[model samples]
Target: MSLPFSPQSSLHQRLRVGLGTMLVPLIMLAGGALISFEGAVGSFEQQDSISRQALFPLAEVEGEILELTSVATHAQPTNTMTLQNYRRKQLVIKSQLALLSDYFQGQPTKFNSVQEIRRQWLEIARLCEQIFEATEPEQLANAKVQLSQRLQGILKNTQELNYRLIAFQNEANFDKARAVREKVRYLVAFISLLALALALLFAFYLSRSITDPLQTLAKGVEKLGQGELHHRITLETQDEFNHLAETFNLMANQLEQSQQDLYRLATLDGLTEVYNRREFNRWLLVEIERSQRGEHPVSLIMVDIDHFKRLNDTYGHQAGDLALCEVAQLLQREVRPGDIVCRYGGEEFGVILPKATSADSWVIAERIRLAIAEKSVVLPSQQHIDMTASLGVATYPDHADCKERLVKQADQALYTAKYQGRNRVHSAEVNECNHQINKLQRMLVKQGT
Candidate 1:
């Protein structure tokens, strides 16, 4: 059976509370008397309500004291948790003593027992300090032996008080306990009502306060998992939750930066900062697929720096690298956002133009060729070097549907431009593109051998 007093609700069990103060050692148990209260209320017999109420909690307090002594004596001296629990249980036992003390008012003889118990508790607490504060094995061993004896004496006195409480030492103590219970019953009833309301309000506020940030953090984690690298957690509580949110955001930032570094290393040219050959090939296939779906034309322009070997031979490799970077940046400026400019290979670049016609691509190729011929790259020694490029433009479905065939057609046209003269643009003529491609392949095979 539960307590009839309104203050007796499990509001405590439902809404967790923590209390902190400096007394002793060990850990999370803050309110154990409340747990014992239910038992105290249930263990009461109507025939002798005073004896049961006072004696039950008293016996529990005695037991807890013994347990604390055992724990203090045997527990590791370095264990921080032992001290925290010892402190918390000490408070709990203190509360129990307070409740029992209330029952002995006006009865001097019975009340002295309560006073002696309090005195013994002070001695026990002193022992507790000595036990926890002891650093060496010898000091700790002496403290433990003394604490065990002190607790045994405390327990013996507590038992005597229990026997006297059961015997009903005075009619005044009984009559007062009964009168006090009535007043307390009404007082607890009112306070319990107030406490219930407060607990509900606190529960609502605490739930929102704690759960809202946790929900935000949980959602942020989910977004990060789905590759939303820019996602961050926003916890505004000036507490540990805020610190946790900061840690999570920091982790996300580092991960996003790491991913970007990896992406650049994988797909961008080291020297030119343009899309590299690998990315170019990948985007070429992607653009072709998009064009196939839309039934729109896609174009490829293959550009090669004219007499690049001669430039390196004359100016040095550093100048050649500078020229490549300058040309790549110029190509990027000349093209639309939709177009992709890539460093195709040594002294070569490829441009993918989606949804563009052969005529459009031809104009772009001419513009690129003109830009390369006009731009002068400054060398490290303050020397200027003018570079020129030969460009070959080929349209998809006009040149060939496959990426390989399209590349071959553009490459062959570029060869044809170089064959006629170096700094000019040539479009792949469909009439002889296959013949030119076969001839180029045969030449490449011969060069390989």
Candidate 2:
């Protein structure tokens, strides 16, 4: 029979069960270890606190007492400043002893020692006071003897306390060192066992939970790389890997859409969204080859926006761009489905009419010119600008019979239309006289005819 909690269960259920089984024992072990360690640590901190706050202040007070005793013994009978110094030292020593009492309040033994020191200090202060009160030379000399004896007693007590604190501190250091050694050994053993258990659990969980899903995802990725854009990753565990699969599916969809958009951008113009110059050249070459094989005519019309620079200077470049786009839209609308419209260059456009003659191309060009002349482009400033265009038409097998020459002939015709006053359509056939004269000149050069 299968177990109640098995590998075939959901990843969340498996993870919950695994963590519950693993962490309970680990936490129990860690709790016991922490309690022991914290007790040792607390003892070490208390020793450190007593040494810094209590012992150091006690030493300072002892030094002050010695200084006061020396000053009291050597003071002249009328030197009031000596009494003031003695009073100041007495006050400082009392304050330090009070502070030490506060630090050792929790320990009855240490507090008792501080109380003993305070009692001895009070006796010494009383002797200093007696010396301050003595006025006669004989009285001052006797007070100095008593003050010296009181100082000796206080010094002996202070030395004893200092030695006790040092011994206690050394014992604390030894205990701290031993505790640290024991803690290190326990921690190493406990952590090694815990880590070993966790490593085994993790290895088992990873193989069950992650490895199969990742292998499936890897295969999906391989399929996607091989152009299986429609392929998707399906995971049912509802884990992070499931989320990753969903994101991967989204990325694949976006990539497929982006590829389509990129292909469209490659063949279309960025501004006018018509066939770009490169695409135009490619289409024209294909049309020319087909025309040559069929002995049929193919026409090309070249268009220019007349006074476009002046329009840009007058209204701004934005208006000029709008005008260009509007003109492209007009040409696209007027041209037949079989014809291809292209943005030839800056402020110029070309249309390829397959199986069309010069007359038909010229008529279409004239229609485009009229449409542009009637159209008004509204600028971003809410201003309208009217514009016009010049067109030139040329046909293959009648105008140079080759793609390059046909385009050149059309361009030349366009130049003539611009020179004859803008907003007009002209044809290469209308300029046949110039072509015949050039041909005769070439023949003359070749044969002296």
Candidate 3:
């Protein structure tokens, strides 16, 4: 059985209290009804026993009458013992009649016929007294006829009344027992109905409470996932459910802030707030794949600040950082959309241009070199510092095969540019390793001559 109250001041408490309340009252009522039914049964048994005791004497007297009558008619000759038995049986019949009168004393009308039968039985008793006094034939015959008739009627009435009274008491007790049983059944049904109703009510309340908050929290979590950090679910109650909702809201807000922080971390270079080396590699690979798939020409331009370490040594590390930022911004301004500019390393940067051939890439690299050359930055000493960059250009499937190799070969060309001159645009085709081999061969021939 379930009760309709909450167990504690919590969200799911109704179920606990509902069952407890229903069980307590139902157990008490069931026990009380059982005891009441048992008491009723005891009373019914006691009444039955009293009725049986009252009827037993009548049954015994009727048996004696039958026996005496049989003896008087069947025996060929009457003996003194028979005479004494007849007289004693007549006396017992009168006594049973008196007892029946007393048993039916309250209902005078019900016993009127039996009372007349009792009066006739009294006459029969007087006749038996006469029989005991005389030993004559004519008197015995008349007395016998009168006594048999009266006694027969009286015995029949007494037995009939006893049977009727026993039957009536039995039926009354049975009806009472049945009624009590039905009452018990009804009480049990009522209790069960009450318990069922309470259980449903408690379930409804608990489910409503739990689901409402859960729905709110679910929506809140979803919105927070979609970047709505300011959303919070309301707590309508002062309970653990409310606390959980509050915590969820807090966690959602924290997660949104964390997501923002991660976004910033992902997009910005850790030191320079420009594109990082990973971004440069990603752009180069994307451009290479796009060019190969679409049959478009892609180009990579590698740039390095001139004497960056010497500049860092001349000024402080902070000035070197400012110089890098200024150079990165200048390079970004010089590039177009679909052109990638990233800080390749500490004092190096890279650009990947999609659909650009070697000549176009070389021209863009030269422009970037000239742009950086034109720009000047104020050092920590409040003096203007002028710097230049060396650039190298390489095209897909022309100077290198893969994006990484292309970028590396361009970086080698940039090294060549730095070696050949301090600041300039150099092409992989110009250095082309084979060109140097031919130049060295020409030099060896000249030395041999």
* Candidate achieving the largest lDDT: 2
Among residues 3 or more apart in sequence or in different chains, the pairs in candidate 3 whose N, CA or C atoms overlap within 3 Å are 2-18, 2-19, 3-18, 3-19, 4-18, 7-13
- Stretches of candidate 2 off by over 4 Å are 1-245, 257-265, 293-295, 430-449
RMSD of each: 28.5, 25.8, 12.4
Candidate 1: worst-modelled 10 consecutive residues by lDDT: 19-28
Q: In model 3, what is the error at residue 295, expressed in angstroms?
A: 3.6
* Per-model tally of clashing residue pairs: 12, 0, 6
> Which residue pairs in candidate 2 collide?
none
Candidates ranked by TM-score, best first?
1, 3, 2
Lowest-scoring 10 consecutive residues by lDDT in candidate 3?
1-10
- Residues 232-326 of candidate 2 have per-residue lDDT tens digits of 99886566678778999999999888876886799889888999999999999999989877868899999999999999899888888898899
Per-residue lDDT for 409 in model 3?
81
Compute the lDDT of residue 121 as modeled in candidate 1.
Answer: 86
On lDDT, the stronger of 1 and 3 is: 1
> How accurate locally, in lDDT, is each candidate?
0.80, 0.83, 0.76
Candidate 1 on 228-269: residue-level lDDT in tens? 999988864555567778999999999999999999999999
RMSD of 2: 25.8
